[model samples]
Target: MKNDSTPITKSRGPAEHEVRAQIVAAATEHFSHFGYEKTTVSDLARVIGYSKAYIYKFFESKQSIGEMICGNCLREIEAEVSAAIGQSDQPPEQLRRMFKACTEASLRLFFRDRKLYEIAASAATERWQTVIVYEANIQRLLREVLQAGRLSGDFERKTPLDETTMAIYLVMRPYLNPLLLQYSFDYTEDAPVQLSNLVLRSLSP
Candidate 1:
């Protein structure tokens, strides 16, 4: 005799992409408020209405979530940099605008979300490769501006492009580094203008 047992169907969960997005979103909120060291997988899972195991399914660890958040913040800054560069026809003006935009974006993000700044600082130390790649990309953008200025006679090209790029990066480090701004609170207000002036002057023909 055939038994009348019904087959049990497992419930379908959120799509992998959806799950990852949700995890990132919840993690962003947690990281923004509580910081990387304080925020845990359990905290994120609780905020997202998921189990820690569920969060783990999407993110390997809390650090992974912090990395994702830092990546998002960097992308936003990159976009701002691109937009600032696009707004000007003159290379020197473009460089100034880019500096202003990037500095402002960094300051805004740092002040608005200190926890996010903590994540960035941690990423710079722990996720060195990722931070290096981002720094390279920014330098590339600066190199483009420098090259354009050289062609337009807006900047003196006595130094090599790579050298000039590195110099600019060094000179602008205080303005660009969130941790530095956090410590040098007095400089925070005047950094964009002061740093941009210094950079533009260094680039001038």
Candidate 2:
């Protein structure tokens, strides 16, 4: 336990940085096994061999730690989506691949660890910064694909880019949002392809 007299520095040393990393690692493992909502900073302190006050030095609250973990899971999904769409395929094919990849990546998270899924659910429900950034990135990726399609003269130029991107993102929202996704799981396999095809047709020149 850090004494009240201990002077907290404005900057973190390498040792302090390592301590932060350890706290995050321990929290992630604990949350994965026991779920995020059920765990408290006190619980983390007990498990991490640190005082609650000490953990507070690294993270102000449990949700702050949950945000980091949830952010990671969402970013991993985006990374997978980026990789899947990295091919030189036509814009139509690329878009289809994006949808499929997103569904796969999100499903991977749900099936990998339900406790982690619980974190995602809470994040999505509460509209955390991670969810905001993740959704924006998805829109940005959609905009890029739409731009490519239009440039190739394969998609209609009548619809504005912003409109098209938002429309497409809204269509894909259920697959992207963990909270909404749980209710729509049944459509995961066929929805991506069929929905992508439908979107492609709508965007056709």
Candidate 3:
């Protein structure tokens, strides 16, 4: 007599992408609330209903998660900058809108949660690759605007394209840097207009 037993298959959990998203989301919350340095893989795993090893399966390390969060932040800013740039045909106006969009986005994120801002700052300093890409993206946007301005005779080409791009980025540092904005005594209602006007004048033909 032959007795046969039914075969059992191991159950599959969430998809890899799903698990990664969940991990990133949970990590974002903890990092935003507790901070990057204080939050750990165990904390993320506990909140995510998984083991620390499971969390590691998705991210290589805590710094990787921080890089993901910072990358997401930069992606959002790029989207906003693209939208603002697309909405205007005039170079000066486009430049103004781009600057406003980027600064406002940064300020909104920084003001909404100081901890998140700190996390991003930390990631920017610790994750050199991410910072390099982020800076390159910003430079590309500035270069596009400056090129448009030069083509339209709105801005005089006083310096090389590369130099002008860096100069614009540096000039806008006060508005773009969250840490600097936090220390500004006059970052009130009139700050945007004042900064925009100053930048426009500097770029004027």
Report the Cα RMSD per candidate. 11.7, 7.7, 11.8
- In model 1, which runs have C-alpha deviations exceeding 4 angstroms? 1-15
C-alpha displacement of 201 in model 3, angstroms?
2.3
- Candidate 2 weakest ten by summed lDDT: 1-10
**Candidate 3 residue-wise lDDT, 153-195, digit = tens:** 9998877989888877886666655556666636635666677
Error of 1 at 27 (Å): 1.4
What are the lDDT figures for the candidates, one per model? 0.73, 0.81, 0.72
Q: Any residue pairs clashing in model 2, and if so which? A: none
lDDT of 3 at 40: 82
lDDT of 2 by residue, 95-178 (tens): 999899988898888658888888888888898877787788888887888898899998999988999899999998888888
The runs of at least 3 residues in candidate 3 whose Cα sits more than 4 Å from the true structure, single-residue gaps closed, are 1-15
Model 1 steric clash pairs: none
- TM-score ranking of the models: 2, 3, 1
- Compute each candidate's TM-score over C-alphas: 0.84, 0.90, 0.85
Full ranking by lDDT: 2, 1, 3
Scored against the true structure, residue 146 in model 1 reaches a CA lDDT of 87
Candidate 2 TM-score over all chains jointly: 0.90
Regions more than 4 Å wrong, model 2: 1-15
